[model samples]
Target: MTDVTLSVPQLHEWELMRAGAYGRALRYELPGDDPHRPSLLVRDTAPGSTLTLLDTEATPIARVRVDGSRTEPEGTWVGGVVEPLREPATPTFPELRPVETGELVAQATLLLGRRHGRLDGTVIVVDTGDAHAVSQTVRGLRHDQVDLRLLPEPAAAHLEGAARTELLVHLASVVFASTVHVIRGEAPAPGDGLVVLFTGLSGSGKSTVARQLTRRLRAETSQRVTLLDGDQVRSMLSSGLGFSRADRELNVRRIGWVASQIAAHGGIAICAPIAPYDSMRQEVRAMAERVGRFILVHVATPLEVCEARDRKGMYAKARAGEIKEFTGISDPYEEPADADIVIGRDDADAETITDRVYRLVMGGPEPDYAI
Candidate 1:
């Protein structure tokens, strides 16, 4: 039998089809000239031939029987599930830490009862962004005959055809259940960890504002506060990295990872970096959000204003072609469209700007300071 490897998303799509979520007449298409496309196998395989489907780890997950009797588009296939060897494996997410084992099992048990009506059969639940270790804990625990499965939340939850029909059936049953017990509880308190990221041009006052904010937070709040200044972090954590685009991105990611760790522990991390690319900032946001709250502060100082304030003559060297990949001069800076707070160069004085950010972080008025 021929073998084909499918990505996680593709595997989910295939599983949906196998579960009759797509009608019998519906066919899947694999376009493009890519050799890995399943269309190649469909064209060559004869009717009734079988193909093995492998996951990213090369583990066999299912088998597909080609129905060559059916005609399809130029690059498409009409395949049916011959057998499903095993359930789709969950994607590995190493960066997130595991939740408490007991808490995870309790939550999984509740979800199983609510969704499946019994705790004996296989039950799939959406992952709660915890690390793989937490999911493994569920496997170690014994819950009578229950088999629990964890699936990540789909990027796009909308479904068509039979899938939608199945969802509607589930919802209707849930609504019309004979005994419905509504459990009420207070909203969860905010997480202890907080990541405040400052992004702007090199000569912008982001570093200065970050330093002041760090001092203020340390003095005012009981939470531990750490400042990750770009230059200081470069000299220590990201030492030996160059100014290339790849290296710069790596440096920013490293800073974000460390900040996320601090946030995970219920501390405050203030980061000041000229994160020129929107993609880099988004990556940082994702990392921080998994563990705690993430606040992005964009210091929107104009490029000309920043150049005028460049006392180090770095901008001059970049304009003279002596330096390559400089952020405002050579490389492009993608301004953030999702900044929680934006401070222009002429917005306000440092104290006023610092006070405004402090209030937002505290969710209310600033506390009085001690002499």
Candidate 2:
């Protein structure tokens, strides 16, 4: 902590806010002026407000006034917004409730941190009428991410590190400077989530169906949902994995690991792979059943239909010299003997498949199977 003092002019800028002290309720001019007209009334102040003042510390602390009469601030002061004491964070914080109209009514303490004034090590306190900015305050008070404290003093001495910022202050400052969106909601229940392993021949609409299911689930429910589509997973988490039989098993196994975690947290995980062997599907099923839910949707589309609808020309390539060992043509697809649900692989209409899986997994009212 560095020690310094403000110039006379900057010192004068120390309103109750900057002075790191609670303030009295009074309406001020929007930009800069005193609002002491006949119609003006200051009842209480709100959080996320700015105030101006004259630094009377050097001059003389006058008798605090309420309305036009002498008053006691400590008695009048209700309580500042309930501010969470923070380390690097100061008083103002994760407030969400927006002040509709700014009418100064009452004042409360705004707690901030200081390099010096360590009263119980407290830095500052601002007066806000009723605490309306709890969320904002909380966001600001979050502990710093990169833990410099973990570094030993000797290690810290040798390393050139960035200046420390309090978690709450830093986050609030960021929200104040940039766009901040706070989204919150509930989650689904156990056995109320779908974990489909779309298995079929290559070009069997496995990825297409899985992608659409993810989109629809997100749109329909507030619950968390994740898609473990084959191609995308291969590129990212399983980048080094390949198409060999052994490699494929490992790849599906990896997907199961992630999916199990997602489902355990009450998220629906939809997996679409050419999980040709029943052994791999069984592994995924065990993982899902142990945690949240599992519904194996076999897109039982026939080989001929899949070959005809080879949109990527994968089947044609496999037949020619261009490609090797494909799922349906060259390799094998051991069908599930006891799949939870099986959809006609030939159909591209995603709604039918989505409804079936949704019902079977969630176990709410059975969706109309009329389709």
lDDT leader: 1
- Candidate 2, residues 242-286, lDDT tens digits: the string is 677877877887788688778766678888878888767877776
Please give, for residues 198-308, the per-residue lDDT of candidate 1 as tens digits.
999998899988999999999999999999999999999999999987778779988998998899789999999898887678878977886689999888888998998
True-vs-predicted CA distance for residue 367, candidate 1, Å: 18
- TM-scores of all predicted structures: 0.59, 0.46
Candidate 2 structure lDDT = 0.48
Off by over 4 Å in 2: 1-194, 345-348, 364-371
RMSD of each: 11.5, 24.2
Model 2 backbone overlap count: 29
Predictions in order: lDDT: 0.63, 0.48
